[model samples]
Target: MADTTQDYTPGSHPDLPPPSSEVGVIGWLRHNLFATPLDWALTILAVYLIYVLVVPALDWMLFSADWAGETRDDCSREGACWVFARVWSKVFIYGRYPVEELWRVNLTFIIQFVGLAALMIPGVPYKKWTGIFLLIPYPIIAFFLLYGGAFGLEPVETSLWGGLMVTLVIAEVGIVASLPIGIVLALGRRSKMPIIRAICVAFIELWRGVPLITVLFMASVMFPLFMPEGVNFDKLLRALIGVAMFSAAYMAEVVRGGLQAIPKGQYEAAQALGLSYPKVMTFIVLPQALKLVIPGIVNTFIGLFKDTTLVLIIGLFDLLGVVQLAATNPDWLGFAVEGYVVAAVGFWIFCFAMSRYSMYMERKLETGHKR
Candidate 1:
């Protein structure tokens, strides 16, 4: 060392430090969950709560469950009687939809799915018109399939329709039908003509002010009074009308927000370019407005989907109604939990996927605007 070797000094090297025992998983747990007495207590309580919930669920649903059987009687254990679900699944999904005509529903589903997928694809030519066609013809084809008197197919009354299938059909139709109606109402509300604005405001406020159940009641009972005699509509159609009208009012407000969000300069610029009002709106304004309100539109749709459950209250056998029916069956008694779980899972999956897609579209359209 005296000859030229440098003396080693602690903390002299910037990169060197004492080894830390407080930087790994143990350290993280200690800092986050056990750093203080209160933190440790809360963490233990949360763990116990989770265990209480999760363990029982796992035991009933998996460990002690009976899944394969022809009847609820086959399930002899003190656990989830999933055999009820297994036996009655078809009825739950299709209601009394005639085993032979099940394929029609499947076909409609395929067509709708393909159409929606096409609509979602980027850079597709004539996408707007394609979407419009998809939205318009869906109800017609679905109607024919579900309520078949055409092409020699037996007419299946809407009263017999139920399960997830009906829920989807109602939700889709409500969303599709409401969009144009809502857009028009929104535009009318913002129109320069005082009469048009007043009319639009009156319609929107009248609808938005009332509960959906009351509107549904009016549709079921009062709507026929308004219509000429011998021009009867199906109960399902009446429900659809109620849902669409109610949704349109809310959607109009949403679209109005989007319209207001667009800069006034855009309108002036479109006018300066000699674009007529309709062209300015269709090409320049509505697209931007709709893009801004995609989330709201999706939310409206989710609400409509959930509201379809209300059809049960009106004696329509939709998904919830069918589940309730199944629950009340003497053969499948005490399976309310299972039936509701199935319905809830189905609704959750649909609403969750739609909400996620709306968020994605918001980001995507934002990118388009930036470009």
Candidate 2:
């Protein structure tokens, strides 16, 4: 040892850290953005395109935008006239709901928010009971709170219901009403009985084949003719029913695909445990299948939510419709862009939230299904 052998321990050379370029932000960029020549080129091109296109757009929308104004006269032609949106904010949110009675609409929204938060957040007590209340009775309470034909509350016609309020009402009702119907249809489509399967197939296809606009048109127009004499169906109610049925058709297909993806062994295993058909599906099959198809189901819901805009065709002014209505006003003649931007952002927020929730569910329910 005193002779020229270096003192060293086997497998120990002061374990070196990875190069800094292979570690943090630099590593991520190298691995993802500049992994190959093609990626490098694409990244550079994307940066260039964003600078060329998005930079000016952002400049117009933010830096030069007129945020402080009470009327269209305050807008300078050089940038976005956000004043139009602000002026018509009432119509955009609560629609023609009486200014004096805006409290009802606001209260309904508060209740909905509270109910949803209590249900969704973890560690809240009595979720099962809360869900039962929300499912069975909350709709009735919300309806009366908005419609107001009882409890000494002044009645607001469905005709007065427009803008984001109506938009959310339609979408929420359609989503809630459609899910169970779709599940039943999905089950029926896969049923052993021939007649039941055929019926489910026919119903799903019939609704799926028709465009949503046509469905809304028929619901608001032709449906009245078929009703009995002296029987008046609320226009909003008709639209709700049409939307739910149409969405249910697409949802059934989604659910069916999920059900099919399930391994046959799972079903056979449940059966072997002496479970009945309904019991097996309720306990095991549906839970797994729904978890797998969360994305698809949420996609359908997003589509339905956007399609709620089409109710404007039936003379119901949704968020978009209200904006369009405001744009036509002589006082706000040339600010359609601002109004449209508001509506677009509103829709994107709701749709994005739903999409994120779907992803969360997917992650929460993740099993050994991924590669």
Instruction: State the lDDT of candidate 2 residue by residue for 32-78, as single tens digits.
Output: 89999999999999999999999988988898899888977788868
Worst 10 residues of 1 by lDDT: 13-22
- RMSD to the native, candidate 2? 3.4
The list of candidate 1 runs beyond 4 A from truth reads: 1-14, 17-22, 121-133, 368-371
lDDT of prediction 2: 0.92
lDDT of 1: 0.88
Best by TM-score: 1
Top candidate when judged by lDDT against the true structure: 2
Q: Quote each prediction's TM-score.
A: 0.91, 0.90
Over all chains combined, what TM-score does candidate 1 have? 0.91
- At residue 203, candidate 1 shows an lDDT of 100
Q: What tens-digit string does per-residue lDDT give for candidate 1 at 1-371?
A: 35865666976845655346477787788888899999989999999998999889888878888887887678966778888877778877888888988998888888888778888878767888877778677678777877899988799888778888889888888988899999999999999999999999999999999988998899899988999988898898899999999999999999999999999999999999999999999999999999889999999999988988998888887788888999999877789988887788889999999999999888877855643
